[model samples]
Target: MTSTDTATREETPSAHVGPRFRPDIEGMRAIAIGLVVVYHAGVSRLPGGFVGVDVFFVISGFLITGLLVREVTTTGRVSLARFYARRAKRLLPATGLVLIVTVLLTWLTVSAVRWREFGVDVVSAATYVVNWRLAARSVDYLAEDVGASPVQHFWSLAVEEQFYIVWPLLLVAIAWLLRRRPGLRPRRVMAVGIAAVIVPSFAYSVYLTSANPATAFFVTPTRLWELGIGAFVAIGATLWTRVPRVAAIVLGWAGFVAVVGSGFLLTTEVAWPGYAALVPTLGTAAMIVAGYTSGRAGVAGLLSWRPAVWVGGISYSLYLWHWPLIVAATAYWGELSGWWGLVVMAVAVVPSWLSLKLIENPIRFAPALSRSNRLALSVGGNFTAVGVVAGLVLVLLVPSTSAPAVTGGASGSGVSGAGALSGTSAPAGTVDSLAEVEGYVPSVVDAEDDVPPYPEECQVDQVSPDPVVCEWGDTEGDLTVALVGDSKAMQYYSPLDAIAKDEGWRIVSMTKSACGFHDGMQVASGEPYTSCAEWNDAVVENLLDLSPDVLVTSERINDALTDPTDVTTRSVDAMVEAMTRQWTTVTEAGIPMVVIADNPSPGDVSPVYECIADNDGDLAACTFDRERGTADSGAAAQLPAARAVEGVRVVDVRDAICPRSRCVPVIGGVLVYRQTSHITDTYARSMQATLAAALVPQVEAATEDAEGS
Candidate 1:
């Protein structure tokens, strides 16, 4: 999504000749765009295809800096107005067009629930601040599992735009600092300024990538060094001509290997663009430097081919058109197969070609705009205005409903949720469609937000290891119940709390997202889940110390693990063994355990909330095969451990979720799932009485056994 120029400007910008063309740079753009396109098209062989963006970052930095430095050396000053006008003319027209088109595509094809978020994303993209917005969302635990935004690729464009704004000012400042010192060359001072950006930004990238990798991916600070690497090449362009011809050839070929090879070697599992990013960025730098020293030789010669240049010509438009097409196609036809993905990518090229011809070229080459900087700036401003207004319109169009929360009454008593399935009364909204489900607890559009609220300290996120306890129910009651494990365990907190209050028992909640109460190592984002392991240890220690009468635990069991070689592997036997050891340790301390089986996830089905919104009358469209939905639940693996451990029993209440073999969208006048496998707070609350019928006896028996022992 990030590029220096559109098709017509592909031949523009030179390292030394002012406005001379650089065919090699054009070819590099083609390669970069190709890597990104292929990677995103579901090519399993190109796990590191995302590194293409890093390549673009380098190219953008080099070309833009070269142009600015040329102007600086010629005029002895930077013309801020004209500089921005040129940028606006080149980048804004295509970007704004893409944004408006993407918003409309989302409205027509995607679910209404996502429209508000996507609309907000569009505005951020228009303002060139989407990188920061995406960074914030990356660290949000609730948003982590949501679908990718169609405009998510705009984050790279945002990073480059931020650089375009600040890097020029920084160059001016460097020139100003050197004005009085006649002995200093401007390039040296500029190089020092570039290093100032590179060093700390790179150090922080490495630090943050390890500490919070998700946020690190989208933040501009972590990626600034990538652009700075290219700036370093531009500042030293004159000296690159002195590089020995043989060395230049070696550098060009080696750089080409590094850039393309990194795409094959790297995967999303690695902490991105930290130290790992150096391969592609440095490789790009080498290629550009080599091209300057030995024109039409080695890698430069290959890149100068006409086909490469043609693709490079349309790289910007291609990058913009491809992602939205993929997103929309996926929405319409479900998860695309590899061939279908390739077809979608091919289809995007037509629009890319059309947009470059009809939208980008006409605006960029218009005589009226070229004649006046103010006119060009004004045109760019209007494009941005159109984008912003379009995005807001999408936000305004999001659907809303006024459904009430379930109150757990008998079917005839204004009841909703699990009560109908429990045969307490006929469910209230069985005959009503999703569009106008009068008695539903939460409208379909609001389902994902229907989760129960928890104190920040109570349920830890992926990064933290400390276990913060929250006491609920009858806190002063004698009998103690502790809820433990990951978010799966946390989902049952509402029902458990209700049961605790009615039974005069205290409830202690100790849970972490993705961290089950197990002794085995877990993997997340291809890295060792060190924090989850630490949290598990801490929670086990807390449980042993408190020795609550009963400990309830559940989690999605199909967690990835790292073998000795650091390769990701999965083994049900390993999970069972780990659970057995952890559960035995707790039960040995006279604390009986109750394992609430994990629920079937709706994630494999279409976006649940959206599907219901579209098929309000035909809810069957939202149904998924029961076996496929529960395949990853890990309940079968859990039972083996539960049976092997003494004083530990399992409570199976899945019937309340999937009464028949198929998992349904709604049950008993209630939206069953919030997101993924997690049930809505209202649905969980409605299950209080049903859960109590099955769970109270087990808790009583466990308590009696504990007292007798």
Candidate 2:
């Protein structure tokens, strides 16, 4: 077997030395980095900016595979230790510095709750398991309302590191097999390896992309095929080198366009790595092959430019640093808007470039340590970082032992007592006096009209009714009002329950996980989801029969509006019609009907909470306007549909929750929203005065009209 040429070609020393830098590749790196930055910076046009990572994967595969093949051919064995040592020298120094700095910054700027979470992420990132950690956490990279994290970019680095761990060993095995068969060509062996890995991995990727896109995107196994494609090109370099210069230039430029274009067109909504991902991955492969085959002057000239090469030199560092900076900046400022966000991005590149130059390069080229010592040091440092982070995380995982104190007494500030007008009150028979009115009855469905209980198998423990008959608001009362709907309606229990108790009303609740009171949507298993529809029908029928003086209902119907044909729409419309029909039943029975509009929903929940928590009470850290729930047109469109029903009084709390064109998380020392999307039970309870203030008048007016008739 002919030996591999592992030595750096003197003609291109930079290509094979410690840096092993490629200018065109660096230019490509610049392009990739630019796309990601612009996309994350909230540029609306480049919906596909996320595909830049795919480009990076292809580049990494080409370079790492080339290095491994060369080393295996020349040395007769691949050095796992040496390869890892070199990686450590190249990656750890800058990464370690960033981690330490970010931790310190987080402690200073973030709240105690948020700091703990960031610290956990820091530990996960330092240990190189950030990808799995994020996947487990269900971190949605495309969620628009999420707060930025300083270390989220590390997930891709973790993926690359995982790839390096396995690839070298696999190559060593292949090399050993080739050595046994003297007739075997290295390129042929590599081709088989690539094919063996790529086909199944790609197939699995396509499958997982639909079933579990988050996992497919973050995990190494699912992503290996994209890298393998580039590996194929590297192994067959000689064949590509035979192509003509003009052809090479044309192919390279065309590939470049495809890769860049993919970034602008593709979006998070697209099923990735199934078919849409081909555009960028194939484009990158084409460019790599074109550059290798043509060896043309124009292609070389464009790639060899100083600026392109310089950015490429620092590409790894830049990629690592940019995301965290953006996230941190966004978290600190709430929303990065106008030129301010751009300025943050620009300022971020400065430290990133500097770190690459001062830290990353020096560690790799340092002469003080021998290869073995360098390897040991690198491994030891990573291990130490991991241990420290792990210890801190364990401390956080330990649940708190003490219960928090509740502030405000029973019959808390705003709660009213019966038979007496409290504070500056409205007269009897007026809306304000409605608070003083006793014996407020809740509407309920009759025994004959009760819908059957939903199938036991379908109910989720936290979200459904296995623990049937949830009681809130002092838990002792004869008059019960059942609260029902999805998470949005569930969030209102705190305030409603408080008010219920103060007014001597009992609260019974039935809620389902993400199941809007829509009729047509299917359950997780693709079977018809009859629970929501059945529950709503039962609640309405029960209200009519039980004859509670009031029927209070709240639901988030906006999600149904995302797709007009969605089952949510049919279910929600059915629910509204049922409720309207029930309203007639209640009105005829002398009961009032109170329908609360669903709270506005932010695009992402965790990120918003994270941003707010991270900012340590900085108003700018939160992104959504406090006054508005969603900017999505789908949400706005639901209003007219809901309002058209007769005798169903629509109570819009948007004005109470949001006043100044912004719906802030905090109102009068109480947090209006607990998570990004929902208000905290404690905070929601505090808003009882505001809610009662808005609702009492409507209830009293209806009650008065009923008595007059």
The most accurate candidate by TM-score is 1
Cα lDDT tens digits for candidate 1, 21-109: 67888899999998999988888888898999999999988878887887777666787887888888887888888988899899988
- Return the TM-score for candidate 1, rounded to 2 decimals: 0.89
Residue 383 in candidate 1, Cα distance off native in Å: 1.8
Error of 2 at 103 (Å): 2.4
| lDDT agreement of model 2 with the native | 0.58
lDDT of 2 by residue, 297-350 (tens): 645457667787676666676666666676667655677773665677677789
Candidate 1: worst-modelled 10 consecutive residues by lDDT: 426-435
Stretches of candidate 1 off by over 4 Å are: 6-17, 136-141, 337-340, 365-375, 401-413, 423-439, 474-480, 499-506, 546-549, 558-568, 602-607, 614-616, 624-631
- CA RMSD, predictions in order: 3.6, 10.5
